[model samples]
Target: MEMQRIMEFPDRIMDKRPRKKPRLTWDMHPPPQPQPPIPPPKVLPTTYHNQEVVNGVAPNHAYPSLFFRGLTRNGSPPWRPDDKDGHYVFAVGDSLTPRYRIIGKMGEGTFGQVLECFDNEKKEAVAIKVVRSINKYREAAMIEIDVLMRLARHDINGARCVQIRNWFDYRNHICIVFEKLGPSLYDFLRKNSYRSFPIDLVREFGRQLLESVAFMHDLCLIHTDLKPENILLVSSEFIKVPDYKFLSRAMKDGSYFKNLPKSSAIKLIDFGSTTFQHQDHSYVVSTRHYRAPEVILGIGWNYPCDLWSVGCILVELCSGEALFQTHENLEHLAMMERVLGPLPPHMIVRADRRADKYFRRGTRLGWPDSSTSRESMRAVWKLHRLPNLIMQHVDHSAGDLIDLLQRLLRYDPAERIKAKEALRHPFFSRDPKRHGYPL
Candidate 1:
């Protein structure tokens, strides 16, 4: 099975600060017409025969061969223990038949806490995300494991996406083993701020991201939480038993550093929030700053939302600032209007009506008010005049970069430029060998 690649990053990257010059000119093309929708399966296949319908699963399952390994048959959870059936407490080793040591806690999210541990036989680092017992959602964690297994074979050289080595269920917790990487993109960004990257370097990063988005879009998958924080970098390759002594010696003297391994690739991190097209019924997901226009109005949006996020990140990289960082939801919409104009009528009609179903109220919704709306317009004008403002820094102006940003950040989802098309833009017209991304 081929591990599909999304983006490649060069090793030994310089951490130099970016120039304060205004953006240079660039190009953006419109998105292609929406593809024809696929017809639904009208007839039930043999796979759907005399089977139990437990936890949203068909009775007779036809397992996928190549990618779908260790798939759970949607087992249902019984009543909670306090009710005398669902309650249970598991110590570190109580779950695993051959349990290992609990090294330390990694994090705690809305779902549950994650712990970092090491497998004895495999001698590898693994992260185990744990969730409380819920009868209705017992199979939910397993679904994530299944998705990760499917995505395991996907690899783009120089990309640092994680792969599942193994998965198992223990008591109330479903433990999934994954390939570990260094600090996440969030940490990297904080340590190295917006000014840390040059325009060219930022463009390269954007290109890689676009390729990843494009690949995911092709598979009809949407990474609801697409942000710098979710990207990972994998550097040193694991050394086996035969090289134990040498590996230890190298570890002592930093042989890994001396050898200067290939540059680690950028990989998308969290998949718990990922959803497949035609399968996923929800429309609401993603962070506020990177959220798409359609999402703000609660419209039934799709993959195009991810593209909007990519564009926002690109602008932040180029200008050392967020494209839209307002105080309130209405102000956010106004800010967007300053650049992309008013919200489309169709988008407003389809806006999400069930606010409690997804996120908190009073949170940003991308709508701009009149007062702030006018200020947003002025900001746009100033941004358009960015070239003149940047005359003191580099030899380029805002004009040099606005065209590219304009096309990528278009408000209209139908008109938004796609990843594949953006790659062919003239901004990357130089050194195809060094920078020509194979997205």
Candidate 2:
């Protein structure tokens, strides 16, 4: 469906020009197939006004526990693997406690499985993320609880965090309740088959995401994994129209909003990589593709690492493809240089010391002149030969997005622009008319 009302603002205070979408043209491609008119997912009533409705029912069977499977892996099946259906199959009727009822399985990960569930009291469909690996589940559950609690307490510009309906800790499992937003950003991009992202939509998504990260930064928390997979849409309606006036005021003054509605806002998930502060801290941790240079090199880093991930997220969102995806350390560095220009002249002491030992196998061992040259870096980036991918999905040339991306992905943590500053760059603040999306 066409976006009903694109956010528009009348303010024209800035003389800056909106960054142009690259002039490059190509073979015209048709829009995606008509997505079957599936009804949007049900929305539960919040403490906010104008609540949306949802539809779904709970299953009558019990959800089988993974405890027995874990035991079997160590030896033989703890119980009979034979059931009436076949070689023992589980159903959803098992998890009917008080507030939650298992409906069906939504997805699974290394530590846990997510179930499409029904919140009995709220009468709303929800996604219940149950940690099956009981031992490893604690860490995930703790992080999820902390992040959700923090978001529930804080207020920010046109941004929304997840709401914890309730949480339960079974003897062998921990189930955290959350309002089930439909699909994740990863799912959306995949459905599109990685092509033709709307420029305005990406900017809008980026702005909201940064605002959320900024809020987390203030709380001294870092979302180590800020990729599309960890970002879930709250509702299609919530993100369509941004509050331009509210966001403008926030940029001008570091103010916060009260009783914010989380309509189209994104709910950050998967804090498995999140690190909390110690009395005195040092070192780094985060995922590979979206990881900041300092973190990758094993140097000390803080919240800014999340901003770096945010930068990568913006590129991916706009292009519907990953920007830096090399698996090898040297190759990854080369890709970074191609997109970000170069590594800084000065390196973090910890990172440098580690690189001296770990990075010795390749030309990266050489300092400055001994290292990979600029031409080689460009060649490595070109080797991917992703021009059509960039043009078709990103709506811009690699160079154009690179210019904007460099500000957020800088090697020097200090040099990396703050979220607020990045939002004001010509990319967003350039045009107050068409580009001035409502907050």
lDDT of each: 0.50, 0.54
- Per-prediction tally of clashes: 35, 18
Q: Compared with the true structure, what per-residue lDDT tens digits does model 2 show for residues 1-439?
A: 1242212222223212221121110111211222222232332211111111122111222323323321111111123232332212236543324345555666766556676666656767776666653455555665666566555556432245655655555334566677666456765544334432456556667778877777777777777778777777766332232323356554542222111213445777766566664423346555567878887676677878888888878877765567776555666665776555556645624465556543433324332235657765554657343344345455333455455677787789888888777767766654435635433
lDDT of 2 at 329: 60
lDDT by residue (tens digit), candidate 1, 1-439:
1121222222233333221121110011111232232333232111111112222222233433222223222222222232233333334322122333344555554455555555544556556555545643446655665555545444423252565655554444455556555544444333333232345555567667877777777777787778665665564221111222234553443222211113335567667777888785465677667777777666567777788888777666554455666544555565676566655554554556653222223343433333445665565454433233233222332444556666777767788887788777766554534645321
Candidate 2 Cα outliers beyond 4 Å, as residue runs: 1-90, 155-159, 236-264, 278-284, 348-353, 357-403, 431-439
RMSD (Å) of each candidate, 1 decimal: 15.6, 14.5
lDDT score for residue 52 of model 2: 19
User: In model 1, which range of ten residues has the least summed lDDT?
Assistant: 22-31
CA lDDT, candidate 1, residue 375: 63
* Candidate 2 Cα deviation (angstroms), residue 145: 1.3
